[model samples]
Target: MPAGIRLFLGYAIAILVLIGLSLRFVIDQAISMPVSPLGVVVMALLAYTIFTTTLVLQRKEAARGLAIGLASLTIPGVPLAWFTFAAGPLGIVLAGLTALLAVALLRGLTGQRTREWLSEP
Candidate 1:
């Protein structure tokens, strides 16, 4: 399988498992399956994966962009997973921090000056 497809499948499976676990929590409590905050985080990551795949599939030279984008996604995703699991306002802070970190990592990987320019007033 192509690298992007492999990534997509792995993340997709992970997302499904997370959702099932969230639902199990509700079921155990005998309550309706309200959306868990963790579910939102997982969904966001899954969306990121899908978006990256779309970018790769649309490019003639997918390697350059695909590798950079995937690295960008992973850079903060690892931390975001921890933050989201912790829950509450701390989770929000973690998500924002993770996004900022991801942008920096992406800039480094792509050799793009967007971050430098954005830092200017």
Candidate 2:
């Protein structure tokens, strides 16, 4: 698929999934999140969305290292830390894992094979 189309579709899918899951959790569990917790979720989603779309646009060489570094520092790291030490919700940890997977897929799409292909014909 074209990069633009893929990116748009990825965004659409991610947003829909996030919204549906969040609503289901809230409605089914009668869960009420504090503003800070909500803010963290929103920030993570926004960061992952930007990073995924950027990777999809063939800017991987520039972004790959940075994205990896960010993921290592934030995604699993912070969520796991919170879940273990600070009593963060399991839902937050799961959301972070999803974001990490999206970024990993985006990175994989720009592998050495594609780089070699671009370097050739």
On lDDT, the leading prediction is 1
Which runs in model 2 stand beyond 4 Å of their true positions? 1-12, 19-34, 58-60, 66-110, 115-121
lDDT of 2 by residue, 19-85 (tens): 6567555444434544455556655765675665556355445444444443343345545555565
Model 1 segments beyond 4 Å from truth? 1-33, 60-70, 76-121
TM-scores vs. true structure, each candidate: 0.34, 0.35
Q: After superposition, how far is residue 15 of candidate 1 from its true place, in Å?
A: 8.9
User: Lowest summed lDDT over 10 consecutive residues: which window, candidate 2?
Assistant: 112-121
What lDDT would each prediction earn against the true structure?
Answer: 0.52, 0.51
lDDT of 2 at 31: 43
Residues 1-121, model 1: lDDT tens digits: 3433344445445545765677555455444435656556656665765665454444424434554655555565756665666766776676666666556545553553322222222
Global CA lDDT computed for model 1: 0.52
